[model samples]
Target: MTKAWAEEILDWNYEPPYDFYNDNNKEESMKELLEAPYFAVLNDSGNLAGFYCIGYAAQVPLGYLFGAYQEDCVDIGLGMKPELTGKGNGGSFIRFVLEQVKGSKSIRLTVADFNERAITLYERAGFKKTYMFAGEEMSFFVMEKRSL
Candidate 1:
C-alpha cells in the first residue's frame, strides 16, 4: 500500500487504521510480502497485480474483540493496485489463495464496517461474519470461511 493507495482506502469511510504506506516505509512493506508462502498476484502479461499474506493472529487489532478463537486458522491481508479497484480482480485473487490453503478448515480476515463493497465481495466469496467490534474511532467485521 503506497501513500496514494492508502489514501484511497481512507476514502471508503469507517475503515480501520492500517499502516498506510509512507514513501519512506514502502520498502519495508514490500520486503515482508516479497518473502515466503505469500501469493503474489500477477497480470496476464506477468506484471504484479497485488499480494496477500496468510498466517494466524489472535486478533487483527489489539482490544478489538481482543481474543477469543484460536487454533487452525488463517489470517490475511491484500491490496490490489489502486487503479484496479473496480476491475473485478478480488474474487479470483481470493480464490487463488483458498486453493493454496485447500487443506485448512478455516480462513479469517478483518474488514472495516464502512467498506460495504469489500464486505459484499467477501460474502460473495463465502466468508461469514463471525465477530464484530466497534471502538472509539473504528468498527470492523471479523469474518471466517469454512473449508470448501
Candidate 2:
C-alpha cells in the first residue's frame, strides 16, 4: 500500500450513532499494515478505494472474544475512506474484496452490533452470524461466509 493509503486507513473513523473505527497511533497502525494481510482496495483509476485485512486475528480491541484466532475460518477487517461512507458503495467494495479471496474455505468478520449498516452489507453478502458478544464499549457480532 502507498503511504497515503496507509495514512487514510490509520485515520479512519465514523460519525455518531455508529462510531466504529478506532484511532491508533501512527507507529502501531503502520506496523500492522506492513506485517498483516491487509490489502488496499482500489478504484478503476488505481487510487485507494478502501482497505481490508484477511487473517485469523482481528484489529479490534478484545477481538479474541469474537474467535478471531481460529485458523479454520479466516477473519476480515475492513474500512472505506471516511468521506466515502454512507454512499452505497460498501457492498460492492466488500464483494470486490471477497472475489480476491474466493479461494478460502470460510471467511469471517466481526462488526460492532451497532454498526447496522455494516451488518446489513455483510448479511446481503451471505455472511451468517456465528455469535455475539460485548467488548470494550460496544456489542459485536461474529459473522461468517463459506465457499463451496
Whole-model lDDT per candidate: 0.62, 0.78
In the range 1-148, model 2's lDDT, one tens digit per residue, is 6677788777777677655476647798788786777888889998787888877435455766665445477678888887788999998999998887787478888888888888999999999887777865788888889777
> What residue runs in model 1 are displaced by over 4 Å at the alpha carbon?
1-31, 34-37, 56-59, 63-65, 68-71
How far does residue 27 in candidate 1 sit from its true spot (Å)?
5.7
TM-score of every candidate: 0.70, 0.86
What are the clashing pairs of model 2?
none
* lDDT for predicted candidate 2 compared with the true structure: 0.78
The most accurate candidate by TM-score is: 2
**Please, what's the RMSD in Å of model 1?**
5.7
Candidate 1: Cα lDDT at 53: 62
- Candidate 2: stretches off by over 4 Å: 57-61, 65-71
Residue pairs of candidate 1 with colliding backbone atoms: none
Candidate 1 C-alpha error for residue 68, in Å: 5.1
